[model samples]
Target: MRITAENFIKHLKKNREEALQYVIDEYIGIVKAIIYNALKSYNDPQIIEECISDTFLGAYENAKQFKGDKEDFRKWICTIAKYKAITKQRKLSKAPFFYEIDETGNAVKSAEDEYLIKSSTEELLMMMSQLEQLDRDIFTMKYFLNMKNEEIAEHCGLTKAAINNRLYRGKKRLQQIHLGGSMS
Candidate 1:
């Protein structure tokens, strides 16, 4: 059968098994590519596969909520794949790995450094969670992705000044949260 998303949606609406299989067959490449781009820096095959699996599972389980052009399915799936990758990134990166594995598989970091790294990361993520969603994304891209202000600005289509303002305000909010005080 032809593999347009419209055909897939019809089969999905009917709860046919082919819808899932067909959607995976037709879209896994693009989905995997989107996920891979998000995960390329880590190079962990297991996490990548899990994110991809979760993406498809999300699509299948929530198929009824998808309403748009069949041709636009690729974009929708890519967005899902990106968020799946982000969730996996959060799980894998909740704490910074202060230690590098040595040649014989021993960690090369001091205990103090590990504690500081974990504690700082936990506090940082907690503070980030309190920011507005767009600010959170910008902060993550800046610090987590190691993107420069120019790159984040370009990717987000905002001016460099706006990106700087977001970073400044985000850091201010982080301090406020850490101090156990409200942003007044």
Candidate 2:
């Protein structure tokens, strides 16, 4: 049967399995696409998967608040996915490290390392902002959401190969710009 927001809400209110399943089955592709596009820049796929799961769980918990059209739902999900991706990125950047100073009056822990990381973080954010909206979306989904190319393709109405191509080119461009700016 076809599922609408009204029906979905009814299922959610009643805590029906079918409704939850309907949402999962129908919207998983869309959710995956939203997630993957929002997280494409992250190098760790595991973190992206966790964030994607968190995004879906958040949607499930807050499904009752979805009081808009289907398109609005899509946008809302995408927004949540993007926010989750950014949060994860911030977490990665803030990851702690231990350093020890060796002998010879040389400092093993240097201030330059900190500055380089800080600068790279800023450069990444700046380069992300410079990307086209569509490219940003694709990047987020692939990297932050940990989605496979086929799923993104289905959700975005593109072929699997096309999604792969877009992701490849987008990543190459982002890396070039970000690294090049930092080096310069």
Candidate 3:
């Protein structure tokens, strides 16, 4: 039998393997795009692929609880992909850094490089802490997760204009903090 959006949930409940395969074939591109955008800072294909697999696993496991048609399924899977990638990114950020040796026997990621990256990220987070929670969330979603204003607004239950305004204001505040030499 040919599987389609209308019958996807039914298939998922009845034959998970087939439904999963169908979902993989149909929505892999969307999932990959969302995951890639979320984990772009990593620049690691293996991590991205792992997050993709986790997303499909999550969707498959939660299929029984899902409702709505194909469009909703697309959105749902995209959300799964995004959150999974973000979770992985957080774990990686907290994990220890691994270094490689170059052909000339120099560490690819030197101590200075590691210190700069770590300090910069720490400094940015410290600066972000000065903003209101909503503004910080908007900035994280927009810059770190690569979400569009519409997506951020939807997630935050605000209008796109409001999201844009918050982002603008947030940047100005962070700029002031940065310029004032308040970051230590």
Using TM-score as the measure, the top candidate is 3
TM-scores, one per candidate: 0.51, 0.45, 0.55
| C-alpha lDDT values of all predictions | 0.72, 0.63, 0.74
Model 3 per-residue lDDT tens digits across residues 75-143? 656656766776677657654555565778644656775566545544665576577667866776786
Once model 3 is optimally superposed onto the true structure by TM-score, how far is the C-alpha of residue 67 displaced, in angstroms?
A: 1.3
Any idea what lDDT model 2 has? 0.63
Q: Write the per-residue lDDT of candidate 1 for residues 59-120, one digit (tens) a residue.
A: 77656656555654565566567666776665456534745778887556668764654455
Error of 2 at 180 (Å): 44
Angstrom error of the Cα, residue 58, model 2: value is 0.5
Model 2 / residue 77 / CA error / Å: 1.3
Instruction: Kindly report which residue stretches of model 1 are placed more than 4 angstroms away from their true locations once superposed.
Output: 1-5, 95-184
Which order, best to worst by lDDT?
Answer: 3, 1, 2
Q: What is the C-alpha lDDT profile of model 2 across 1-184, one tens digit per residue? A: 5556667756654666666676667677766676566667776677778877876665666666555555545655665566666665665555444345466643354587656644554455447556655666676567656578888888788898888888777777787786665322
Global Cα lDDT for candidate 3: 0.74
Error of 2 at 154 (Å): 25
